[model samples]
Target: MVDSSKTHEPLLVARGITRLFGNAYALSDASIALCRHEICGLLGANGAGKSTLSRIVCGHLPASSGEILFKGAPLTAGSARDALRSGIALVAQETSLAPDMSVLENIFLPSYALPGRLSFSQLRHKARAILSELGHDHALPLDIEVRRLSTAQRQLVEIAKALALNADLVIFDEPTASLSPLEVDRLFDIMGRLKSSGKALAFVSHRLEEVFAITDRVTILREGKTVAEGVPTAGLTQADVIRHMVGRDIGNVYRKAVSPAVTNEQAVALEVTGLHAPPIVRDVSFTVRKGEILGLGGLVGAGRSESAEAIFGLRHRSGGRVLVGGKEIAPNSPIAAIRAGLGMVAEDRRTQNIVPDMTVGENLFLAQMGKHRGFGRGHSARRKQAHELISRLGLPTDRMDANLLHFSGGMQQKVVIARWLLIEPEVLILDEPTKGVDIGTRQTIYELLREVAERGIAVVVISSDFEELLGLCERIVVVSDGYTIADLPTSRLSEESLTLLAAPRSSAERNAAFLRDLVAGHGGTAFWGLIDEDRFVCLAVAESARSAPMGLAAGHVYLAHETAIPLALGRRQPGHVTESDGRSTVLTPLSNRRGHDLGWIGLSLPAGSKLPNAETLSARVAGLFDTPQDEKIDA
Candidate 1:
């Protein structure tokens, strides 16, 4: 993946950058280089020194120790004007365009505000030519007001403005947060044009998919220091990047759910019928079994969130009936739903989820205050419970009294999950439970959900990742444009099938057109793979195994007969089975006597299906069967 277009010297370079805030270091001994025709991604979780570096490079903030060089010339500090004059430009995430001015004026406003003011007509012509060079559609008319433009269109104008300044290095900080997918594609097209035209770019975004999709390389920071650098996009998985950032191998991110213990099977935890919401959802119906994980999947804005809200009494449903544990629940009131043993963790944690100013202890017991003794529990009691949750969820508590705003984004998300976990609801709904959290936190959240479900709680998770739903849910319901398109066991769903079902078009149409072309374009290989409850079908097992599964689980090749098969193991199955001849080649299920498969053993046979040694196989089987089914793996 050598970028041949990059033939110039370093367009910008920073050496030994360091920034300190109070006693804590924000950035230390950091360095970076940018070449014209290359796009570099600055990646890290919140508070990972990315913003600090950006500010330093743009000369908005002075670094305690560091040297910045542009075109081999030493750079000045706190003089943004000097940096701009030197051909540097930065586009912050916050909207900076003038609202009342026309798009053309805003595009050339920086230059127009310079010492020698240019006429409005001359600036408009320059803006138009610059916008055209950046591949922006001129038909939209530059005379349109900035306030009326869409977020994506505004981003285009921002880039056009940069081109007008003839900036050699352009830095974009989370530029596509509010842009739609189609708009993002258009922005990427513009970025490609910039790259081809020999301009350097530095991008900061929370979306790892976008980073890997566009950036030539990435730098990962942790604790104000460069933890990892020079990570190429090629051969990188989301998990790989997460592991580097989080310092752990988060095993089975979507943890296995507690298989329902079939006692008192008549209990109905949640029931919904005739659920209708606008834009995508319409007339949805479903029932969640007690102690089961029900998964919801669909394309973005397919009314999954609406359905969750409607059921939780958060949305005003035109027509819908929500019954919790055999009682008809009312709509449009979250408090009523909570009283009915239902709890929901909304999608956007920043706005709709946690309370930022609250302490960790206060946030943990937010929902359970009414259940405590007296009007409210004493501070000591609440502190005790908060400490317990912190220990159980492995939350960082060195600064427990600190506000949630002080913690990293992942930590804040964990606090949100902990808040719900303390409530002990009968029916819990999680919408994108692990959206911004690191891999380690995601695993913890998964385990926490599984623990809740094991207590006979019905759980529903709405996720954008198809693989997540397939790996965690006992049964998945595919919703498309407000309609229940498919309901099936996790075993019956493959990534291709789920994607096809979740798409806007009918399955037949997708198979005939999109699927045919996708398959052909992909060289007839299913790139996404089948996602089952506990495992996923991987292409080239050897290649996958080489990277090692996250965490301490060691890779192994056990003779299917060598490993022990414990008694009543829940849903965990053995290694993925493949067929060659009539022989039944099996991967030994990694399990304890309690039947919890921790790992797997792979075996293959070329000829007969019969066991190699009937007596030995029988003995092993009998031993496993004799073990008590109630044994639990201490996972």
Candidate 2:
């Protein structure tokens, strides 16, 4: 769709870029060109030099060897400030904002380097305008501390900071990782505006659909070298991109073979009853059966990761009972949890899982060292098993002595996972296990996880990728605002329904308050839920004292006939439908500004009670989420 002939001269160019970390090359002989009025997509697997090149260009790190030109002149930047002054900016994948500072302060952080009298009022006005242009004016509070914002909100700040510089060349690295669908769309629109303004942009992402939607030109990298440079985006397909990224054809990633279902009689491998960790995790509870793969699904700050940490003893629990293999384990002690047949692979692999200074073999045996009682490293006892796992994971034994940091991100993640597999625990909890892994390696990890589950180890995976959760898990637990909202079989849920269920408690609270008002005003029971044919999934419920029970509760699934208001659920019309149980029910569909369905809101009243007009009630439900131009659906 991009007219290549009419394009202006390139804004920036890098040739033969090379970056080395110890003995391994993170980027080698990589070249790219970004022209004005176009968005060039940087495509690659994890550790494919995309981030390395972006950093080198932004002066985050000096290239080991390379030449870069900007505006037809040799560009030399000694620090990030130099790059900023030169009209270059980068929105890093991992947020770089200062947590303790206010949103306003972080947005104008680059301005602090400018030699001039400081003006907080001027900076605040500019920050507000930038956020407004990005369609997040009220969503971000200028005075609020960055630490209190969620991951998605933090990413917005990063974007605003980059925009504040009005840089000629801007690079966005995995910017959509923490954003919702609506936010992603808004970001794309902003990028379009930037391109129209003749600002060169580079989009770095693993999401193929997004690449196809926005990119004008694409550059693919593998290992550390550029495989395909400056190829037209319209000429390539998803398969071609994947092939170039992984250097081979990768079949369906989720290759778990069908297996017999585990009965209810099967022993519970891990159970958390009334799990409570203040401010993050509250009243979280779930059960994983032996050989079953269960997914914990939610948005970025929904306490899914915190719940896993609490269950595995990484975080202190105010009150809860963790049972592993039918025996209660002590809280707030990772050592005791591991000894009790529990293992956890933390979310942040670099800071929490990998020891950069240690050898690959040593990192692999670190968990074994903790579990072993012997004074020596105790690695000798597990060396044979370690070797076997390495072979199974397609890793070479000769590289065992190398530093773990020298390997690719996928290889590093495999080593971290192998460390846990060495312990051979009954329950394994992994948070964002495939966060930065490549597609090919992702398939391998999926197979490995399936094999682990087949071997009778209960596997709990916490992920923000809804498609991955649905494809890999038999059941899913939806967490929102630290509460376990719904537990349903994967067969009965879709990504749309999961997104609605995983909506933040702030959004749910509004709907809950509306339900309460309905009950108080009408003297009946009101509920919010999703309905598909004969199935219904309740999200929240409120009832008046005089109202009769409807046999419905929150965080539950039921067949249409199982509830007292079956007729209303079966026929989801806008008007009231009377049920056989002498209850009158009204159901109204809910949607956001983008027309994304948020399921249905229903009210059930006794046959004799006064009823509000159906049209008025529907308007009230719509009014709850009907913002003028901003539809902040807490995905």
Best by TM-score: 2
Find the candidate with the highest lDDT and give its number: 2
User: lDDT for each of the candidates?
Assistant: 0.64, 0.85
Q: For residues 321-353, what per-residue lDDT tens digits would candidate 2 score against the true structure?
A: 999999999999998999899999987676679
How many residue pairs of model 2 clash at the backbone? 0
Residue 613, candidate 1: C-alpha displacement in angstroms = 55
Cand. 2 Cα-lDDT: 0.85
lDDT of 1 by residue, 1-635 (tens): 11223334778878788998777788888777788888888777666778788878987788999888888888874666767877788876545689799988888777854787578888777776666544344333788898755444666677677667878888887776544343355468778878889999888776677888899877777667766665566657777777666666556566564464434464779888888755445878888888888898775546787799788776787787899988988778777787788888887666577787887767767777634446645456556666788878777767677777766666777777777667667899988776645446666777877777777889999876666678778788877667776676776666555654564433223123322332233222111122234333321121123222212111111222322211101223333233322323333332335343223323233233333343443343334335432121111
Per-candidate TM vs. native? 0.63, 0.88
